[model samples]
Target: MLPCRNRTGKMRLGASIESRPAEVETRKTFGHWEIDTVIGKKKGKNAVVLTLVERNTDFYITRKIPAKAASAVNSEIKQLFSDFGKKPEKIFMTLTADRGLEFASLAELENESTKIYFAHPYSSYEREINERHNRILRRFIPKGTDINKISEEELERIEDLINGLPRKRLGYKTPEELFNEQLDLIYRL
Candidate 1:
């Protein structure tokens, strides 16, 4: 992928296939997060859903936002974390996002503890967790359907189903299991 050229000639930082390749080595960090947006419907009329997955625990969070505009995405992210109760150190330690303008203001997400990184555009393999999570989400909310119509209660149910699925990646453990384990570990400390 080329440097994201917004309407202006300025080079925007987004996932560029050439820049971010597959992981050279997988690290065992717990708080590293993979972030991406799922766009539904046609170009003109669409709802964007932001999805995040924790690399170590396979925990996930999904939030439906108004559009893919950077401002909305950023605001939704803030809201999601706030809804989860922001203890920045315990929540997100680092974030990896694709080359979408929606993530351009990643610095705002950074606390002294949380770092933000970017994946090369079109490099789906880099954010593999988000990629697979999106596929699972598609089972309930197919592509080309307006996410706006989906109520929060329904979305929570979808999230519950996704979290409750037995994941081969986790040795047949459900994401909820791994997520709770990690949370328990943190509390025990």
Candidate 2:
């Protein structure tokens, strides 16, 4: 992977994660998310998985893309946000991602109520929640496995299994429970 600077010359498009608001760090807000792409084995025209995890609730979302191109990834991101309905900004307040070229167009996601932040180079820990979720996904879809062979139903099952598992950090509640609670709050607001 080339350095993010190599792709954009001098100017980086988004704010650094270090500049992210304190509320985001505390994970008290429901809208902040960390995004990443999980690629299948290196092969001709291999498909990839686009993953997003809500910071506060650890809610995970994934979509399969034809490839790891930035355009495909951006399109999936747009579609995901569009699924949130009229005011996507209300549900997608902030997105933090690494400097992957696949996320190069992430700035297009920013709006009046939403912002995008890029983690510093070589700092995967900054997106810890996302990384952890990806690791769990690997249990079902091992590395080097062809993503093209995985059906949507299988992916949904994997997602459900991960979200349904209770977590001690979340007071033993499943991510699905907390995520649903947050969504209810958002709707009630």
Candidate 3:
């Protein structure tokens, strides 16, 4: 794809990953997240999977978006605002995304409570959380499998199964468990 540019043709990107807080790298805090899109066909307007993995607890979210377009992702983000409910800021403290044109609008979501960061071009390692989970996700939906063909319910089921699995990384605790604990604390405050 050609570079995403403005009317004046200036390529647009958000705050550099370098600007991200040092604490984010340590993964000791809740709410920091890594986001990405998983696409099937390289050719069609098929649906894509929007994946987000919480840096701290490994809580994963998968939403089947209409397409790999800015509008679709933005709409989904708006939908998440309602899903996150009364205080989205507590759950969505910071978002680290790639320099995809579709994510060009994500910077607009930044405020006092939420910030957006972009990894350097070609640097997928910076967002390893999304990468590893996407590999796990690939077990259910292989590469090149048309994401649009998977029903929303099935996708959600796959997510639930993965999130329900216990992990050695968290001392055998499932991601959902730790995630719920964080939610309890956030909502309890």
Candidate 4:
């Protein structure tokens, strides 16, 4: 796989993950997210899940997408941005993603309030939160299982289960609790 930056030092993808603000790395603030895709099968461009986990609270969001193409990913992302139905821009400060073709169109979404950063090819560690949560998600949607068979209700149940679990690293607080609290604060502002 080609690195995000080429020999000429030009970024073939979007901006480097290193260029993301310091607060994002430290998870000192909210709204920073790490995103990735979970495919059911690679045989065809069937269905997939677009997962986004907040860097700070580990609040994960999943969307059942039609395919792993740029259009599907971008559409779901835009839908997520509008989930709040108002002042949606304030909810997505930045997003860190891998150098996949599905993410190629993400650079177009970058603006004043929302920034998009691409991790170096083959470097999954940069999106650790997303990777870890994906592992947990695999418990429900195992590899080789056609995700298209999984109904949206089942996916939401799995997502809720994960978000409701208390984590020691999070001071024993559930991600859902913290996520809702933070989201409330954002909407209030």
Backbone clashes in model 2? 0
What C-alpha lDDT values do all the predictions have? Answer: 0.76, 0.89, 0.92, 0.89
lDDT per residue as tens, model 2, 131-186: 99999999999989999999888888899999999999899999899998987877
Error of 2 at 184 (Å): 1.1
- Lowest lDDT 10-residue stretch of candidate 4: 2-11
Q: Which of 2 and 3 is ahead in lDDT?
A: 3
Q: Write the per-residue lDDT of candidate 3 for residues 1-189, one digit (tens) a residue.
A: 899666786456789999999999999999999999998887878999999999999999999999998888889987986798898898998999999988989988788999999998899999998999999999999888998899999999999998999999899999999999999898899
**Ranking according to lDDT, highest score first:** 3, 4, 2, 1
lDDT of 4 by residue, 1-189 (tens): 966754695448778988889989898788889999999888975899999999889899988999998899999888887777787666689999999888989888888889999999899999998999999999999999998898999999999999999999899999999999988897787
Tens digit of lDDT per residue, candidate 1, span 26-69? 53656668888888786675577888988877777888888887
lDDT of 4 at 23: 86
